[model samples]
Target: MNLLSKFATVGGATLVSRIFGFVREMLMASALGIGPVADAFNLAFRFPNLFRRFFAEGAMNSAFVPLFSKALEEKGEAAARDFATQVFSFLTVVLFALTVPAIIFMPFLVRTVIAPGLNVCIDEAALQQALSCEDRFGITVAFSRIMFPYLASMSLVAMVGGILNAYRRFFAAAAAPALLNVVLIGVLVWALWDGQDTRALGFAMSWGVLVAGVAQFVMVTVAMRMAGFSVALRRPRWTPDLKRLLVLAGPAALIGGITQINLFVGQAIASFKPGAVSILTYADRPYQLPLGMVGVAIGVVLLPELSRALKGGRLDEAQHTQNRSLEFALFLTLPAAVALFIIPEPIIRIIYERGAFTPSTTAAVAAVLGIYALGLPAFVMIRVFTPGYFAREDTRRPMMVTMASAGANTVLSVALFYVMAEQGIALATSLAGWLNALLLFHGLYSRNLWIVDRSLVKRCCLLLLCAALMGGVLLLLMPLLSHWIQPGAGIGVQVLAIGILVAAAVASYFALCFVTGAADRQMISRMLAARRKRGARNA
Candidate 1:
């Protein structure tokens, strides 16, 4: 697949999921509006996603795919099949056993993880001025309980996804997450029809995640079966393979995946404010858009490619892929980070401003969005860089880096939470992100692993310039777009506004790239030309 085609396959599906996720969050905002219910659901949703990223997404992929690919290369499909089946069977048993307790103790988890905050909003005038909203802290315990099992299923889905990646089964694996978004949209729409009570929305959304997690797991498994990858039960072997997986993945689960940890850090600190968790949650979505598309995409696609290349004794190609992917990340994500920082108000107002969520809340959430935006590029890079060490099956170095970064993040978050409020929490995360990146690069340099090539560095400078030129277009266009898509604006108008802005920004960037001879333009053009040819041939 061409680069844009590959991006489209993964990012296109992700964009669908994110759009539906937007609808889900909109229904949630209309119904819950950043209060106790929103807080409860956000925290509840966060717990599972946190571990999902750690154990399943980054950590698992980092460890498993390289090894699995090696087995696939050396021993053929049967050996890889046996290994995948053993991992899956053992994974299912362990996840279920762990999830059972988590579901049972969901209340305790909420209490422990979300540190006791100002349990009640003492400022009634503040509430009345913002909107006629009441504090609803009780939902946090019950709704969180309803949603914890999602972790178990999603963890498995991650493993299944990892197996699929090893097999180069990218499409189904990429599309799997859209199901979760679809389910949440259904449940949230149902809840919207019902009413705007905190419990009504919280319960619907939480239950949606649980249901969606199960559905996704089933979908991927079916896809696997259809591909003739029959998964059979095997005892947990803790074999050399499993041993290597654990050894490599454990620390990455913490330090390298510290971005996930940042969510909990923000939540723990936000618990003090009645609606703080929800605000953090709402703000996070925008940041996640770029992070997932650019960072997560490169990480997932490149790991397998890198694994195969390195395994086949193609070290130069492996390093080239790594540099090229990082170049891709910077090119795509920089402007997202810039737009988020520059115009948080319009972005928040456009996506979420509605009936119950007011201007003040938008401003508050926007502030956090700006803070989080500062870390956006760094966050995307984490996914890009960490795979370098992981694909080599050298997980321990990353672990050491991860633990050190986690310690720094934790200490910074705890200290900064008291000093700066929600923004402080985000700032701490931003600091920790740069710290983690520094350490990763330091290790790579110390060992003389991979360095940015001259051509790539030249391309990097041009990418920044192109992004700057695009930002100028955005700064000029955003206000016009926002005004055209005001709160009372219909969905058609809103869609048009977003379409124009996005198209304009993308076009401007490509024009700048062509002018500057940036790296991605030729790759992107080749991708578009290939797509056109594919379309023609299919017709």
Candidate 2:
């Protein structure tokens, strides 16, 4: 399959997952709102997900895919399988050791690392007599313990996913995340049907997270087997290959650690104000749609693709891959960021306003979402650029760059928390994302590892102009459609309004792209022709 085809495979699946995620978040808002239980559940899940990203997605993808791809490219499937098995055995043992202690020490983690701001609730009079501090803290601990096992499951999933992507089987692993949303949606549906309270729903959802993790692991494992590869855990041994994998992965792990620390700092600060954590999370969902679709597609597809190209000493192919991935990331993300920045409230209102999600809550979430939108391109570009480093097995540079950005994020978040509440935290994160992206870009360019192709640079400038025009269109349209998207509007009306706005915005943007020559017709034709050929081959 071609590059765009691979992107479509992963991106199409991620789009499904993100859609289900939206439905799941909407149900969650209805059942829990931004209440104590919502806060606890968001915090609980964030804790495990932090490690999931740190150990699994960020570290494993960076280290594992390249090594595995190199083995498959140079050595053979047998060598690749051996290396994968060793990593699997060692990773399993490590995750087991990690999960047990995490669950056992859940309380301490909650009090210190997870959500330190929750300590304010212990003082009762410190913030307000809002809810039971003891109850919130206790359930948060319980929820964390219940869901911590998910890290193990997802770690295995990531390992298997790396194996699959190394073989260019992208759909299964990308689709696995949708199962989480589906499982949680089922849990919420049952809770809503059974008339469960917020506390009961929180416990149910936490368990649902663990179950979804297992499901995802199973899905990816099956995909690997079907692809004629299987990983059996051997007794743990420090094979040279395993040592090399860890050596490469270590810096990536630290990178993930720093990034998660930045996130935890934001969450901790948000925890000081009631509902701030959930508000930020809710605001995060809309922009995540585009990020997940474009950014994830690029990250997952580009790494393995680049590894193969660079391993074969195909410098031109690798450079072309980098340039196209960068162009594609910006093309899709810029308009999205613009739209989110221009009209976040309408989007947030349409999605979350139905349930216990109040207009006031919508306002708060919308503000944060707008700030996040400003950084959307940066977030996606990070994905595009990092593969340039990782595909060459250069993990340390990105780690150092990540450290600088995370440090900036920390200082800025602390500085801004006193001024703007949750929105301040969001702004810090967005700014940090840009810093990370720019530094990564400069690192690549300065080393001549990623030379700026003329097409890429020109298309980027044109895309920016197109996005700006689209933003202007949305600005003109939002006020005109305010009644249809207002708080008390019918859900159908709101949906239709959003649909119309999106259609108009997208139509105008594409039209402008074609008119201004930002979008290459011949390149699009090749993508389409490749799609046809692949379909014919399948038939």
Pick the lDDT winner. 2
Cα lDDT tens digits, model 2, 87-138, are 9999999999988888888899999988888887444453222568888899
Question: What is the Cα-based lDDT of residue 265 in candidate 2?
Answer: 74
Among the numbered candidates, top TM-score falls to 2
How well does candidate 1 match the true structure in TM-score terms? Answer: 0.92
**Cα-based lDDT for every prediction:** 0.76, 0.88
How well is each residue in 192-263 modelled by candidate 1, as lDDT tens digits?
Answer: 676645556667777788899899989989988877787787777778877776776676566445788877
* Candidate 2 local lDDT, residue 119: 86
Query: Which pairs clash (backbone N, Cα, C closer than 3 Å) in model 2?
Result: none
Worst 10 residues of 2 by lDDT: 121-130
The C-alpha stretches of model 2 lying farther than 4 A from their native spots are 122-130, 256-261, 536-539
